[model samples]
Target: MLSVQPVSEAGFAAMAEEWRMCLEASDANPLFMSWPWLYSWWETWSQVLGMELVLLGVFDQRGELVGIGPFCRRVLVTPGGVRVARLYMIGNAWRLAPTVRTEYCAIIARRGSEQAVTAALVPALEQLKWDEMISTDVPVDQLESLKVGRFYDQRGYRMIHRTEDVGIRINTTGRFDDWLAGLGKNTRLKAYNRRSYLKKQGELDFLDHEEGRDGDFFGRLNAFHMNRWGKPAFDREALRFHRLLLQRLHLCEGEPAMSLILYNEHCVSVLYDVVVRGCRYNLQAGYEEDFDPKVSLGYLHLGHAIEAAFSDGATSAYDLLAGNGKNQFYKSHFHGEAVHFSTFQVVRSPLLKALYRIQAASPLFMARGLSRRVGL
Candidate 1:
């Protein structure tokens, strides 16, 4: 038999080791799902957003921790002025949606215990006062499984599953040169021309910073990203969250995983990455827009990062994480496999179900509304 219990922030902190053990025991765990990342996110963003942490723990009869559902509770006021109590992943907040923007989220469980853990999670979640439970970036099959769907049906909850975004990933097992050779002739020509043009400017250097070594990189990354986006990549609190994340990763002896391109001692581009298990997640990046219009420094930096990944034996996949409308062109150039992510929204209230139905019927309008609500 298994039992579910709600864990407070303090309790969650105390169970760090057990949480890590559960994460390691699970298969297909990503860097975003790691203990250090979520915990640091909670510590940094929860208070600022006034979110109530609802971390759930599942234990076996022997009192051994079996699974963890890192979640939080917040209130969402829809465009129709409906106030709905919602439960979301820890890194998510109502105002920011995905406050920390971690991908591949799910209940962390032992390799063979996913079904049981997910089954138990449904009833536990139903008992909460939240009108809706929103889980984003979960595996497709996991959301489609009978265990989850059936459990939601038994609890009188309407389950709405939709593909949120397509993630881009590249298998880095092959040689970097071979991978480059597979690109279109135009791509190859552009890459060569860009590199040749940049080489004439000055000495070029590629640097990798590990944990405990990323001093001003984060600030520089933020500035560069702001320059590109015309706004901060993450707000002040989110920035602090990333700093704490680096510290926590350092303490755990995990890889900080950042890459930068320096031209004549000046940083031209930076790639913020995270390496976990065997996969490397390209979380964020930015480049100097004014460097040289003719030379695509951003493309050059990405090429170098891919080469570095191959050289370092990070032989697993290189994930571009979630794709957005603005980045599709750049992501398309990589020729990576597109893996789709799904979100499961379980709503117990009939009114909320109707709202979801209406939202689904007109996704474009809802997207624009959401953009306005969140100031996106």
Candidate 2:
């Protein structure tokens, strides 16, 4: 028999050893599901955002734990003075969805008893009384075979989907030279010539966070990000949260995974990336926009970075997180492959659902559309 239950702090304490062991086994394993930080992030955000948080786990007949899902609850005030509590979380949390990383990532038994674990969870989810659930940025490929429909449908919850290209990567037959040769001759010459031009400006450098020396790294990173975009790309709150995460975090701990920033003597740029399971998760990247675009510092940084990743044994590099038209232009140049991720909107309250529909369709929609003209 399989059973599901909420994970309490005390209960989590008891499971610490097993939890840590399982998490360390995979880079994509959701670290946000664990104690301390998971709870910290949840509690901190829940208080400010007013979301109820639940850490749920699944266990087998032998009672060996197999899955974890972090469900965040939100209460939406309706038109009729009715207030409904909704439970939702970023998909890819709990290390369940085996693709990109996000909060409350779904976890599943990848090997033993995979089918059994999934079967138990599907029915459990359908029976859940939550008002609304928005599982955002989920790996569609992982859920396709698992049949997510067993738990959700358009009748009860509207399923929405979109895609974006994550970033760039070069296949390595050898070192940087071999990889550059793979690109078209003109592209290769352009990249090489740009590097030659940049060298004349000043020395170029890439810095990674070092123990007790991260302050300088983050400073340079911030400068790079600000330089790339005159205004902040991410919200102030999100950036603050990332700073905290970086302070107490390790990206897969022992791997070559580390936050990096590239700079010339005069300016800087930051590369937002994560290495998980021999794959480089190329998140958002920024460079000094004031620098000459013709010199192509961003492209040069990326070329060297890709070579570095391959040298370190990363098999693949994922571009914008998902593929979109705008994101595809640059991604295509580097031979990016498409991976489908999913988004879901489950609004149990008719009024709130209506509001969401409007919100999704309004002119604000076009204005706030994920796609922007520059910077993928």
- Against the true structure, whose TM-score is highest? 1
**How close is every model to the real structure, measured as TM-score?**
0.87, 0.72
C-alpha lDDT of all candidate models, in order: 0.73, 0.52
* Candidate 2 residue runs with Cα over 4 Å from true position: 9-17, 23-44, 78-84, 90-105, 145-147, 151-178, 184-193, 207-215, 227-230, 233-236, 247-264, 314-320, 323-329, 346-376
lDDT of 1 by residue, 56-153 (tens): 89999998888887889887676657777888887656345447676677778888888788777767876788887777777565554322546666
Over 1-376, each residue of candidate 2 has an lDDT whose tens digit, in order, gives 7798777756643665565555554322344444334544543355556655566677767776666555656666544455666666622232121222453244545355556666777666667777655565555444542335445665565544333224233444356666666677656655554666666766766666464855554455556666555555455444555555554444324133444444443435666665544455555566666666566555666665676666675454433344433233555566444544555555555665565566566686453442232100
Q: After superposition, how far is residue 164 of candidate 1 from its true place, in Å?
A: 2.3
256, model 1: CA deviation in Å? 1.5
| Local distance difference test, candidate 2 | 0.52
Count of backbone collisions within predicted model 1: 0
C-alpha lDDT of residue 123 in model 1: 77
